[model samples]
Target: MNDESWALSPNTRKPLPQLIEDKIRQLIDSGHFKAGDRLPTEPELAQKMAVARSSLRTALQRLQLQGIVEVMRGRGWYVRSTSVSDRDESLVIDSRISDSDLMEVRIALEATAASLAALRADDGELDEIAKRAREHQGASTEDKEELLQTDEEFHAAVVKASHNELLEQLYRSLVPKLRGYRRNSYGSAELHNRSANDHNQVAWFLKRRDEGGARTAMTTHLLGLYNDLATQAGTAAGERAELNTFAWEDEPRWRDR
Candidate 1:
């Protein structure tokens, strides 16, 4: 390994362990290390990065959570292939869904959930939903992933509150896809705030026991997301076509456009 290239320079802003993890990911992506390649010994890597052994281990553990690397007993850390196929089964299924299609199904299911929740949700269920919404609203910029998780929890709470077992099962099955969408679109603080506001509106209607209002609120929120994603997809398609006219030729000719 090239110690000079891999070495981490002094930085005060971000945590040292996170920086180390980022550098390791960069190395893997840049082909400095390939799948199944064993990482350098902990002490060696720590010396190279000018960090403590404990810090290096901490970074490695973070990478392990991300599926970027794996630790072998009595051995060492090895690079894991960061391929789409390596993702969770549900996430792999999510990858196959178009944004528009997923949004359509989500809108249908969640609007119904909101309507039912307004009528069926008890005080306790409403309180749980409110708590989740509050947590999401209070989340900071550094808590983007946490916010996404909270967003799902809030939605799930609403679905559960509907008291429809089949509806809840269907919504649970779509969790992975919903998570993928939120993670992609909720990267910006502005988007996060917008989503929180939408959730608040839905919760408000449900709290008032206004089923029609709750359904409308949920529908409007999902429709807004669908429009945004559709526009983004159209723009990306146009840009890719303009940049490379032959880009489509690389794919299976039999595949649908």
Candidate 2:
């Protein structure tokens, strides 16, 4: 593999860690690092890329979150899989449930949580929610894992503030199932910024103890996310169709049987 082909060049507009991470992805795409291949040691990779060790580690962590790489305890980081479909399959629990189905349940629970939270949350709970929202907004784009974590924390706070044990328990169980979809939905900077703004609006309504306003804001945000996910899925399907048309000219093996 030619190191020059995957060289990391610092961009003024993007974080250094992000640049490094992008280069790593390019390496994977170019066959420099195949699935199950062990990544170079931290110091070696950092020196090779002419970047700080910390920056390289941060980049690796981002890839890990995306399921591109996996760190084996006391062993080292290795490429998990190059294909997004492979990674998605591993993250998803049930093949029967679609993204739309997940979103339907999430919207109902989140809206109810927001409404109840507005009615029940005290000043302290509102303060905690605000703090999480601020953290999410301040997070850098390269730190998407942290951003997602804070976003979950903010929602969890809202659920907790609702003071409904059954609702809280149900939401908690659904969270793990939604992790992959949530990450995909919030992948871009634009989406993240929009979500943060939506969260602020919900927080504002909660602080004012306006149950209706909070519920409406939450509902709108979740619905927007669902639409975005649907659009993305459609686009991806189109791309796959184009690729298959060109690459699979002959009928599939099973089709002839």
Candidate 3:
């Protein structure tokens, strides 16, 4: 028998392309795919997955966009990770960020917005928050997208209420991706309902302008997911917390645009 050192041992469970991408991400995240490491060619991957090269390519392209891998014209693809940064930028753009990274980002954004929202939101904004919350609650399973949209709208509205246009715009840009990652990473009905409940509290606090309550609610709401992601976040934040320290929030934005 010709033994291939790189081959994943055959398992009863077959992996789809999406699953393959996720597995590869876990490998990269765990240092199995180090920076400058050349991923095996498409045919090698196809053999390993017991699938076609095309599917592997599709997975690789998705990873490419996630900044998990970089493709070179002649040299082939290499793992793109260095010391992974866990701040706003890393969380904002990571298409396949683990559940823990999603939770961490949510804690920072949601808790901060909660207080700002309660303090600065106008009546119209408060009403909008109510309308979206009701809309989310009323949706049946057929309206998953709407439920998801309303969830984002409720939180983004809180960020907008902060009266800082930059924070509002940043939230606007990040929330869609945030929602998308959570859906992909968790995809649990219980988690979805939990997210809605957390959002409802934020909306309620917005209406009442209860700064302390909002902050506490947002922080508490994010805790479950944060705990869930904590094990995975060890790669970026726990032992690696020192490299994770980049003061982007303290850095000034040249916002003439």
Measured over all alpha carbons after superposition, the RMSD of each candidate to the real structure, in angstroms, is 13.8, 15.2, 14.7
The C-alpha lDDT values of all candidates are 0.72, 0.74, 0.61
By summed lDDT, the worst window of 10 consecutive residues in model 2 runs over: 238-247
Taking the tens digit of each residue's C-alpha lDDT, what string does model 1 give over 1-257? 66678876567687677789878887888888889999998987888888877557657755654456766656889997655355232233446767666776777888899999999999978987888788778776575556655676678778878998677656655665565566677677788888889889888988999987788788777767766877777845333211111235431111122
- Return the lDDT, model 3, position 172: 46
Best-matching candidate per lDDT? 2
1 or 2: which has the higher lDDT? 2
Candidate 2 residue-wise lDDT, 1-257, digit = tens: 55676577657797787899899988898787899899988888987898887577667765665557866756888998898565533444475776766776777888899999999998988998898789888877776657766777688778878988667656655665766777656567888899899999999999999987798788777777766666666745332211111125321111110
lDDT of 3 by residue, 8-107 (tens): 4355374455666766776777676788899888887778667666457656755654556766656788987645572234545656765555555556
Clashing pairs in 3: 100-229
Prediction-by-prediction clash tally: 0, 0, 1
TM-scores vs. true structure, each candidate: 0.55, 0.55, 0.49
**Cα deviation of 44 in candidate 1 (Å)?**
33
